[model samples]
Target: MRRPATTRAITRATTLAAAALVAAGSLSACAVGGSDDGPLVVVSTNILGDVVENLVGDEVEVMTLMKPDADPHSFEISAQEAARLRSADLVVSNGLGLEEGLQQHLDAAADEDVPTFVAGDVIEVLEYAEGDAAGTPDSHFWTDPARVLDVVDALAPVLADLDGVDAGVVEEQAADYRAEVEQVDAEMTESFASIPAERRALVTNHHVFGYLADRFDFEVVGAVIPGGTTLAAPSASDLADLVGAVEETGVPTIFAESSSPDRLVQALASEADVHVDVVELFTESLTAPDGGAPDYLTMMRVNTERITDGLSA
Candidate 1:
């Protein structure tokens, strides 16, 4: 069964719905901040923010720069946040060109010698299989739980090195989270095993599923957008080409990422000759506390179930 929207999600939707009229007045009030005390760990994206929080618990203050439902490709940070990044005890970011807008700030933080951890560094990276970004390293490694476990394993030692954190506590917490991640991995493997080989094809808003496809032995049929980033738009010919691919593959469902608008995917489904269904997946970011995908593990499970159901039907 599909989950209902959380209270925080409803509140965020309402805020955005009214932003055009009230943004100017609400600018100062909406600024994000965390406690000035304790060891501060600044994270570029909310997805990583959740992971860091789970691993460290209340031992450190995690300041997640990206808001829930925000696109990491184009989400910009405030000057205050950038300053925080430079001064943070440790800064965590999803690297390999994922944070396009925040790259300069990340560079600035590193320039100032903030200990930084890039999640992409520890995993076996996959390249974009096709499109304009073909052959470029794909930074969406978290799609594969095995790769995510690599990140978890590498991160535990780093968190243990943090000055205020108890090394034993960090290791224990990471072990617990590691077990949870492994359980999700086993569940995903079992669930995806049920999908027929012919039906294991993915089409998304962009080329975000390359790692998932590589991990699960699925074919990346194509994408509505031509590249790895959602900031890029599709041309008419691009859409036409994708329509042909969809018709050829006869994939029942095409996915739209939650962090991006589904209009283009919906339009592509409408344009397809086959009866295509557009399903939303939490590809880039996590949702609020009451959301279906509030954390990394839940996000993967929700997506695994959705993909299984979407393709099985």
Candidate 2:
């Protein structure tokens, strides 16, 4: 027997619809300091949210739109939250078309003169070289810790200048945090250097590791999905070709994206008839507080360790 939906469900639907309408409405309705909830910084992804929180400390409130273990490409915010974007003290996003659904909202905030920092803008961006997505900018720049340093360089000053926040604390934290990033970068270099370059080939759920490959001398042998984004579907021939690549490359593992399902990669491994292992990595999103990857540094270190371990096997 079917159970009828409750009033709470109907109220939730109405709230989302209202938010959409507000998001689509005039920016003129946006108020000064948009959130009375307190000194606020709104970030599009949990990863960047963690970065910003580290810089700001407890001086301000950080509103992260995307939850842990969620895909950033297709995630959307409430219209009310979209409206709040225009009013926040600062907005940070990993811009290169990574936030597919939320780009318009980011743009709206920028259009309203909200000082928005895009991670892609500060870092040297990589473009897709082949396929239909050829020439499209890859937004997965955080894969390289060095490029993320560029992001920190560009944002540190802007964050220091925000009103109601202690500039000294921001600078101090940024420097300390940058040092931590540098240390991690050195460790990753030393560790991955141990792996034979030929053995350092990779296959992922999607085209996500271009920067990481470029930085660490790893080869992006192939992907289960064809494009830079996860929403892409693979044709049978695509899977067949990837299977052949796997066989030829002798790559040992196919990394299942943490934010996405591994069923496809699992099936791909079976279909390819290869004895490859499928491993999960926190690729795009962070995890809950108690999960394996709770922040950017931990996420990168965990991935580095896993990648090294997998390929070295």
Note the Cα lDDT for every prediction shown: 0.89, 0.88
Model 1, CA-based lDDT: 0.89
| Per-prediction backbone clash count | 0, 1
Q: Please give the TM-score that candidate 2 achieves against the real structure.
A: 0.86
Which candidate comes out best when scored by lDDT? Answer: 1
Candidate 2 regions exceeding 4 Å error are: 1-38
- Report the CA-based lDDT of candidate 2 relative to the real structure: 0.88
lDDT of candidate 2 over 189-219, digit per residue (tens) = 9989988878899898888999999988888
Q: 94-152, model 1: which lDDT tens digit per residue?
A: 99899999999999999999999999999899888677888999988889889988988
TM-scores for candidates 1 onward, in order: 0.87, 0.86
Candidate of highest TM-score: 1
